[model samples]
Target: MSSTTRILLGLALGAAAGLILAWFDPAHAARAVQFAQPIGRLWLNALQMTVVPLVLALVIIGVSAANDAAASGRTARRALVVFALLLSAGAAFAAIVAPLALSLLPRDPALIDSLRDAIPAQAAPAAVGFADWFTAIIPTNAIAAAAQSAMLPLVVFALFFGFALTRIDATRRERMVEFFQAIADTMIVIVQWVLWAAPLGVFALVLAVCASAGASVLSALGWYIALLCAMYLAVTLLLYPVAVVFGGTRLRRFAAAILPAQVVAASTQSSLASLPAMVESARDRLGQPRAVAALVLPMAVSLFRITSPMQYIGAASFVAWIYGIEVPAAQLAAAAALAVVVSLGSVGLPGQVSFMATTMPVTAAMGLPVAPLGLLLAVDTIPDVFATVGNVSADLTASSVVARAEGSSEPAAPA
Candidate 1:
């Protein structure tokens, strides 16, 4: 069987096994989940270990080999515009649709109260200002940023370092580009080795999640969970047609291409972990040029999180609907704007923490209770899988669109 098929099978079997265990023996299942957590973490660490070096090398080589600074800047601007539009659409859809869908669901105050009680309180960080957001992108210490997996700062440093090569002697520049290319090629090999364990890793990860959270946790927040899943599914489904119609990608081709990356994203719940798969898929399956894949995918991972706006806006809207808070049109607009800014700014943070930090201010702005966030976080795991899939799909779609626009109609020869 193909690796993608194996990964899918692992997901199904692991979830089934976990659910059965949870149904039969909650205590033992919890213990099993505890044991599996470390295995899953180890797998995730193995993937993350490649992210810094891989991303840095990709950015450096892509920039250094660009046709010209002006052309590269135009490509970057086009990518950003596409990213912003997609984010806005997601946020708007969630803001408009979630509240209406949530209203139709049967309200259960008792269940909501119980869920809130079960979740421990977490203090939200102070809101990030525009200055702090922009400043954080530039690394004060590149080494420290890499060590911490600070993606935005590391990307910024890589861009500067890559551009600096263009100003040097031609021979030296070519040598440096070749060196980074070698590093990138090496990291891609390491990523492939890591992904060979994907089925096992995905199984462990999914098993841990299902065993620990169980059906009971989901039962308590059924409506909320259902709404988020529905929204994520809708957005994910919509992306395909958009890619096909506008980006000239075939649906089957796109789906098959992105499957491995989507699976990794679903299992690991970290787009950074799935970056290698995305880059590979874009180059090999989607037929994007090397420069476009390298340039677009890394930047997309760092800046263009399409799911963030949807998730944050959906969570906030759900909270408002549950509490009978009337968020005016103006407030919803403000929330959408905030969602875009936060989604763009919260690069490199853990998915959940970033969601909370970015959404908290919008919640406060809309006059909704912040306590419900803990409950949202509690049930966010399953929904996160779909969200990650959406993000990875968008990464590939964006790459294809950008590549086509840049006139790289044919895929570059694989490195």
Candidate 2:
């Protein structure tokens, strides 16, 4: 069987086993999940271990491989414009649609009380001024930023380093590019090796999560899950039409090209793992120039994250609805803005870890409780598949859009 099939099987069997165990005896299942927690942690750690090195290598190599600073800057500008537009649309969709969908679900007073009880008695986070956020992007120490998994600062530093490399003598620059290319290639190999254990890893991770939460947790959060899935579907369905209309991609062709990558992304719930497939789709299927695909796709893998705004906004809205908190229009706008900024800055973090880091601050900034985030994290695994699929789809679509805009029909000779 294919790896994708195996992953799906693992997810199904794991969730079934966990739910069955939980149904039989919640306490025992929790204990079992606790015992299996290390396996899941190891899998996550293995993936996380590749992130910092992989991102650093990709950014450095991508920038260095560019034709020149002008070309790179133009590409960056176009890609960011596309990313920002799509992200804003997604955020608006989530901010409006999610709350409406959530409102339709019958409220569970018991679940509400449970979530309320879970809230920690802590003060709301201090307001983060615009100046604070701007300064935080340029880290004083790159090492410290990487150590703390501060991906935005790390990315900024990599961009600067990569740009500086472009200004040096050709021979020296080529040597440096070759060095980072080797590192990037090495990390890709490591990722493949790590993913060899994906089925087991996914099984253990889902089993642990399900066993800890039990079937009741699933039932209680069913509506929230439904809302999230709906939002993902809505965004994904909208993406293709946009790609077809504006990007000039054929719908049938786009689907056929992107399906393999989407399958990998859905199964693995990791966009990074699907990067190779996305690049292939962009270059061979969508007819993007090699230079454009190489530059846009790798950077998208680290930075674009098209589904982030929707997911984060939906989560925040759901939390507010559940807690009976009244979020005004102004606060919602602020939350959307914050989510966009955080999503862009969330490069290189593991999937769930990235969600939490980006979402918690929004929750805090909105004056909502962060306690229910644990529960959200528990159930986020299933919806995360859809989210990853959305992200991968957007990545390819954006590449196609940027490539077309650059008027590059044929593959550019490699730098």
Candidate 3:
């Protein structure tokens, strides 16, 4: 079976075991939760340890890549600017939509009990006023921030470091990029190694949760899948209008051109893998100039993922809902900006890796607990289909926008 299936099977079998134990003997169910909690915690720690360094490296690389594009020419610069604005808009959009969507769903008290029961209790976080948050944006000490795991400030340092690399001599800049690239590649391998143990980790985690609250966790999880799928589909449909209005492309023709690429994206769940289909659609169906399509599509795949912000913000919002935290507008705004930055930095990551790597920071930024994320990751395979589709749709739309910006005069192909 595939890795996703293995982890999901682990989730299923765990729920079954936990439910049976809970049904047969409440005493034993409590014991099972106690037994499984430590193992699951260890796995979560393993996933989190990689986040700091991986994000540092990724932010540097992502920023430097965009800077390089900005230097290439006017067209490339415009595309980069457009990509940044679009990513920010998606992040802000999710901040609003996810909370509203969760409000409409039934809140399960047992689900909260299950999460709180599965993990050990901690001291509540102190409230930080707006002044405190604004001051924390630029890290006074980068090393201190990393040690404290202050992701938002540490991310700020990384962003500055990335731009700094662009100003130095070319040879030195090349060396730094190479060095960070090696670190990123090495961390990816480590994360892959950690996830290879995911089935066991998921089993332990879900067993504890289900043992504590039986099947109520299932209801909350169902809400997540449905909500996220709807978010992605909404984003996908949202892009068609963007292509028509901003891109100045015919609506029917744009829709028809992007359909095949969306299909490939849904099946593969990889934008890099879907590149050829996007190029083909852009060149053959949209009638964008070959040069514009070629340049913009690849760049979009690397730097722009419309759903990354949505996923990050959505995961954080779901966690907040589970814990009954009323996320202040201040915190949600911080989370939105954090989501856009981290998502840009970590584009094109594997699903499992991105789920942990990108989502943890936003969760932490919003002051939500990260413990429930392991359970959420197990079910991401379902919504990832729609996430990829949304991404492909955005990629094609971006190409159309860039083509228009470049003043491509090629006559449109038939829908």
Candidate 4:
């Protein structure tokens, strides 16, 4: 089957499973659904098994390449600056859209009251202080950090190893790079095989979630989904075009070229999973160099995740409002800055919730009431889909800027 055919098949099967599971009452399929939970767990494990190594390899390669380009003349500096600007714009757009969407949403006083009641009130963090931020990154045990998938420490370790490789003898550095590359390749092969079965896995996972929780969680969440879609649309239509113009790329062409991948990302709800399609699109349609596309796209998948922060921002804001906690403007700014730190400091798959758990000072300072993360946990699927699409789209746009700055012979084309 064609790639499109496969994607459609997966989507259809996954949707079928979700609908069936949603319709399943505990009285009807308690034992069978209970039995199916472990299968979903196993599937999650398959994806997670690749998480650390995939992140380490991709980060090492990206920084190494970025460092090389940075060490070059003015052109490379310009490219790096443009890429940074694009990232900033995407993140800022997400943050702005959250508040704007909140404004547009019809405040359901009754539903809000019910949700507020459901949420246990807790004391806000004592202060927006630095101690909490400092303590989050410096884990006592490397193993414990890895077990918890502490993103900052993991990123620190990967950066340390990559840069350290640069300073060593050329022959040994090559050997070390090759060693990591080999491991990365092996893991990618494993991921490919598992992805072949992902349709079943995705279906089972959705089934488990629906069966256990029921649709009540999302019945009143239509507004949340709409808010996320608006945010996604803002990033794509407004921020990205501005980025393209600023970066000296042809804005119309860039968006056109990347539409296929963006659509796929929306369906898959995973930037990491969409890497192959993004890379292919960048190389073939966008005319990016294979070397640049290969190195940057994977790194962007693992490291340059802006959307997770956006999700966290939206979740945090909603939860704060639900709890009647006043988040001052200063706190929102602090939250945005912290969002960047938490995103960069995180490891594992892009869009994973654990990263937020690890990076947010609020998660630590606020207790169990904050623990539920109820707002996001309710509408994760909808937001995750939109965010993943935006994340990959932004990455592709940055790649175009980078390619142009590198002075590649390929003329600027519409993406």
lDDT of 2: 0.71
Top-scoring candidate (lDDT) = 3
Instruction: Give the least accurate 10-residue stretch of model 1, judged by summed lDDT.
Output: 116-125
Give, for candidate 2, the lowest lDDT window spanning 10 residues.
Answer: 116-125
- lDDT per residue as tens, model 1, 1-415: 9655666677667667778887999888878777776776576567656656866776676565343433667777778778878889889888888878877866656434433332212332245555665576678999998886555566678778987988999899889888988886776677667667867776776676557555443453567778878888898888898889767888998888888899999898778899999988888888888877888888888777888787777888877765545676655666776667556645655544454445665675455655455445444666778888888888888887888788766653353
- Alpha-carbon shift of residue 310 in model 4 (angstroms): 1.0
Q: Rate residue 257 of model 4 by lDDT.
A: 70
What local lDDT score does residue 283 receive in model 4, on the 0 to 100 scale?
84
Task: Give a tens-digit lDDT track for model 2, residues 318-340.
Answer: 87877666666655666776667
* CA lDDT of each prediction against the hidden true structure: 0.70, 0.71, 0.87, 0.57
TM-score, one value per model: 0.58, 0.62, 0.96, 0.58
TM-score of 3: 0.96
- Ordered from best to worst lDDT, the candidate numbers read 3, 2, 1, 4
After TM-score superposition, the amount by which residue 300's alpha carbon in candidate 2 deviates from its true location, in angstroms, is 0.8
The Cα error of candidate 2 at residue 203, in Å, is 19
Clashing pairs in 3: none
> How far off is residue 366 in model 3, in Å?
0.9
- Writing each residue's lDDT as its tens digit, candidate 3 over 159-189 gives 9999999999999999999999899888899
CA RMSD of all predictions: 11.1, 8.2, 1.6, 8.1
